[model samples]
Target: MKVRVGFGYDVHALVPERDLWLGGVKIEHTMGLQGHSDADVLIHAICDALLGAANMRDIGYHFPDTAGEYKDIDSKILLFDTMELLRDAGYTLGNIDATVAAERPKLNPHIPEMKRVMADVLQVDVEDISIKATTTEKLGFTGRQEGIAAYATVLIQK
Candidate 1:
């Protein structure tokens, strides 16, 4: 079997009136990430990682913000579509390790739900996907609560 790995990262600014979504789970927060879609940075990172692993390009290539169909669209759909593209290309998911960076609302407590939701969306065992969250120690935009960022690494095999 041929095995490959891919890494992805995404970030978005925080803005008022937007809902916070990470790993497919909506969390209570005073500010939400701003983007053309639902602004789920974690999900976007995962999508990019999966696409990169398969050499299929990134999420923006497949789903451009300029397209009206993707405006305010749910990011989970993008993730699901990305997985389908990989499957069609004869690749199967091996595992994924992902981390989200944010300063407020404390993410560790929501990791479980995030894993469950993402696993369901990816149709993979929850064990195959590991989600973690951290603070930047007030060193970056994330720590300052100006924005949120996420990183994802994935292993895939054919």
Candidate 2:
């Protein structure tokens, strides 16, 4: 078996009047992430990791923000498409570990749902995907509640 590893990171500014989405699940919060899509930072990071593992480029390459079709699109669709792209490249997921950084709204309570949602979207065992949350200790954009950021690492094999 051939195994490959990839890493991804993403950030989005928080703004009013938008729904906060992470790992394909929406969380109730005073502010939401701003982006062309639903701005699920976790899912976007995972997609980039998968694409990088397959050496097929990144999510922006496959789904450009400049395209009107992606405007306000659901990120779960993007995750599904990313999985298809990996499968087409003859790569299957081994595992994924992802972390989200935020200062408010308490992410820990929502992690389980996020894992379930992402697993369903990727058609993978929930055990294969691990989602974690953390605070930046009142530093940087995430710490200051200006934005949310996520990092993901993935293992893929053929």
**Against the true structure, candidate 1 has what lDDT?**
0.94
TM per prediction: 0.99, 0.99
Write the residue-wise lDDT of candidate 1 on 1-158 in tens digits.
99999999999999999999988889999888899999999999999999999999999999999999999999999999999999999999999999998888799989999999889988999999999888999988888899999999999999
* Candidate 2 ranges with C-alpha deviation above 4 Å: none
Q: Kindly list the per-residue Cα lDDT of model 2 for residues 1-158, writing each as its tens digit.
A: 99999999999999999999988888999999999999999999999999999898999999999999999999999999999998988999999999999999799989899999989988999999999999999999888999999999999999
| Lowest-sum lDDT 10-residue window in model 2 | 22-31
Q: Which ten residues in a row have the lowest lDDT in candidate 1?
A: 135-144
Computed on alpha carbons, the lDDT of every model, listed in order, comes to 0.94, 0.94
Q: Residue 149 of model 1: what lDDT?
A: 93
